[model samples]
Target: MNDLVLTGDRPTGPLHLGHYFGSLANRVRLQERFPMYVLIADYQVITDRDVPGEIRRHTTELLLDYLAVGIDPAKVTIFQHSAIPELNQLLLPFLSLVSVAELRRNPTVKDEIAHSSQSAVSGLMFTYPVHQAADILFCKGTLVPVGRDQLPHVEVTRLVARRFNERYGEVFPLPEALLGEQPLLRGLDGGKMSKSRGNAIPLSATEDETAALIRRAVTDPDRVITYDEERRPGVAGLLTLAGLCLGRSPGELAEEIGDGGAATLKRVTTEAVNEFLRPIRKRRAELGAGDVRRILAEGNARARERAVRTLEEVRVAMGF
Candidate 1:
């Protein structure tokens, strides 16, 4: 079987530092090693229905961020999820492979419910992992690169594939999780780096804007220079940010700042982050709207061709 890697981001907002440090930077390397499919999950964006305009603009903006961050159009297939109907169609049968109780137990769903803090959760939100399973299994993905929080989705995809093979003939390979080692990066306010929280530093933000965000980023309130995440989450957060951006270790940074103040750590963290983003910012600006549009158009064509082929197989298998 061919080694295929599937990964993507929800186009709910501009790609941010959390995305960059968490997984996007890793994709630059993985794309060279595996047959990578970078999906722009626009359909998933509608899970929260209030942000239609944000989703539309972000879909295009995400394409720009991918281009700016060295996601080569020639090396990887970049596709919008909504543009591929076959995958969505697969969600119907695939949904039956797993139980509603199983879905409720999924950590991802639980986290989303808690994050939204809403009593009314949409069916789309509840069933998203099954849809994601369809997305991966439809493409016959063998390797899924994701952070630890996403491990549950990969687990569910594996379960769905196993069940589908047992119910029908063997139709899909169980995909494995390629988990990252770094701790989950947090937003400026010490929460997760989320656009909804308004604490994210957009991958497309200017150097000045990025610096400004870092300045406001929550740091150790104790005003001490130590890097104790348990005692000083804010300073520890900055250390994590710097380490992730500079490709250094947080422990090393902690030792380096023997007697420095929180201001020093902040300054150093800001500089490290800005320096890291300099190239991407320049490329993001250089990637004009017309160029981004053309890339997505080509990506859409390539994606549809593959989706059509996969749907043909599904139809034949199920006697559709």
Candidate 2:
């Protein structure tokens, strides 16, 4: 069996520092070791009924971010999810293996519904986990890199794969979730780093913008810079951000900062984050629009070839 890995992000916005440490950095490394498929999940964006125009723009922006982060198109297949019809085709059978009650019980899906603005959950949103299963199984992915929150989705994927195999012979590999060691980063306001919240520092943001965002980050009123997450979540969050950028533990940095206080912590974090993002910002600026388009074209073609083979196998196995 070939070593295949599949992972992706919704093109809801530009990638951010939270994304880098969360998953993008891992993709850069994994591409070197496995035949990796990094998808631009355009269809998944519609789970919330997002604007089509915005999704198109963000998709290109995301592709640029992937390139800026050293996800070599030459090594990794980076495709737009909507471009692969086979993935959508596979979703129907996978849905049959799961019930509405099971989908409703999914913790991840429940959290998303609670967070979304819709009064009634869209059928698309409710069934997206099965859609995600199709995304993974259509590629015969053996490994999926994700954060803790996404573990439920991976579980659903495994269940769908197992059920399909038991019913129609073995046609898919049971993909395993590869969780990252780094903790998820919080937004400037101390909540989850989200684009809609206006707290995220986009990977494509200018150096000045990044520093400005850090300056506005919430911190504690305490005089001493301590890393107590419960009492000083804001200050601790900033320290966590700084630590990720500076290669030090948050507690260690908090102690090193000593009496410099919250103001000092913010200043140090701004400097470290800017210095770290300098090269990425510079490289992103240097990429022309034409370069991004060409890369996507090539990647989509390569991904389609593999997806076609997998879907063909599925059809033959199930007598489609």
Candidate 3:
């Protein structure tokens, strides 16, 4: 079988600029070159939260964002995580391959637990990396598109694949990380970009909303604009956003806007981001919930076919 692209987002909220620079942009580029599968990690959304929240609504919005951003359902297989039971079933055997101690060692998992406000960590959240493995291996996915922070999670997936093949038989291809070309787009406050923190700009935001959000970005109190990532990450981040949208270098953009300060920087960045999202927002407006559901239904059927076949192989490998 040929290498398949498997990558996805947790359907917790609308995607943001970080999502675009990190994975969505790459997915649009790779869809033409390879058979890509975009997963809506619906189950993973509950890994940390107490309630499922508006999963159905959030999942639909995520799908709409995918299409609006040019991830065509005709070419890319977009499937929901919970819809495929066989795929989740792989977690049982895959989980057995990993140790609780080993799970504790995953840096991403540790970071997530630390970030979560609740004192207790959910079992599903603790074993998140193994669930990630099941997400990739069940589809025989060999190329996973991810940001820098997600690399460790993929490493855990690779480990499970290697160990399972050793014992159960050669059932999975060791997947490789296709890192995003951009640097980490930190939150407006120079921390993680999350909606809960009120530091994200959703792709579906209007020009006014975009402008309003940028207005609150945390920049150092210097009245000059320069791209100093170490000392001025917040200002530098705004520059990066403008650069990505305008197709220019952040340093170059900073030089052009010398002494422009946070006001000018935010204005320029807002203009750039809104201009970049205009077409995407228009496309998003044209998408309907009906279309989203139909596309997912089709994708789920296709994904189940692939997952069922993989599980059949696993059973045979173990002489079940």
Candidate 4:
């Protein structure tokens, strides 16, 4: 069998279009070819001191988004990170292999700290890369599907795996990143698409909600619509979104909408987006709470089985 593939998302909010185009779509294809493990990274959410109530509520929402996007639990093992205690046990040994200064210097961690509203960084926040390493290695993950920005986190996982094997003899396989061809979709405000920014259109969003969000999306003040990301990010973002929905190039969409103006662009974009999301929203509405609970229960059990085996091997190798 091919090396196992591992990836996940923090259940902070409902999954959005950025996630659908960026990774979720790729995951739907990958699960058919590889032994894949998709994690609901609940533990990682608390790194920023998020309330437990919110995490619990959003976890269910995130799962529904996964199913709505066609992430079949039968094909991919969708598991909760915190459900596997062995994953936490692996974190201690992995943390020892890396230094504090190195963790502080991780670009991804630094970016999170800079953008966060917190005045002070939590130790959990600082050490999340270690936790992520644990999440991957606990599954013996040899291939990690991630975005370009997340390459650094995967690199840290490789470093941890290499150091552990060097000191204790070979055990973990160093995981490589598989980046998707899809471009990173920007938020409605022409920035990173995040729920915290209130700029994302959730996969579960109604047709009216999607239309309202796209109507208010930032666009170039100039009359004509064009696709120049460097000079006119707002217009370019709308074009990119429309292209993703309609299966055309942003440049092609730009030319098609030439001299149509921002109002025209927004109108086309709103229609394209709502049309694209119509089916996903319908499927999500069809899923009952019982369906989500049953999926999680089965996934958590399968994940624990793999995690336990990996942890036992690590313990013996480390003479613990």
Clashing pairs in 3: none
lDDT of 2 by residue, 1-320 (tens): 88789998889888888889888888888988999888899988878754445887898899989989889888888899988888888888889999889999999998898887656668998788999998888778989988788999999999999998999999888999988785768899998787878888899988788878888888767788988878878888889999999999999999999999877898899898988888887888889899988988888888788778988887888897
- As for lDDT, the candidate ahead, 2 or 3, is 3
TM-score of each: 0.91, 0.94, 0.93, 0.95
Give every collision pair in model 4. none
Better of 1 and 3 by TM-score: 3
Tens-place lDDT digits, model 4, residues 78-125: 999889998999999999999999998899999888776555778888
Can you tell me which runs of candidate 3 are displaced by over 4 Å?
A: none
Cα-based lDDT at residue 134, candidate 3? 95
- Residue 231 deviation, candidate 2, in Å? 0.7
Candidate 2, residue 194: how far the Cα is off, in Å? 2.2
Tens-digit lDDT string for candidate 3 (138-221): 988999987788899899999999999999778899999987676677777877676777788998899999999899999988
Better of 1 and 4 by TM-score: 4
Candidate 2 weakest ten by summed lDDT: 46-55
TM-score of 3: 0.93
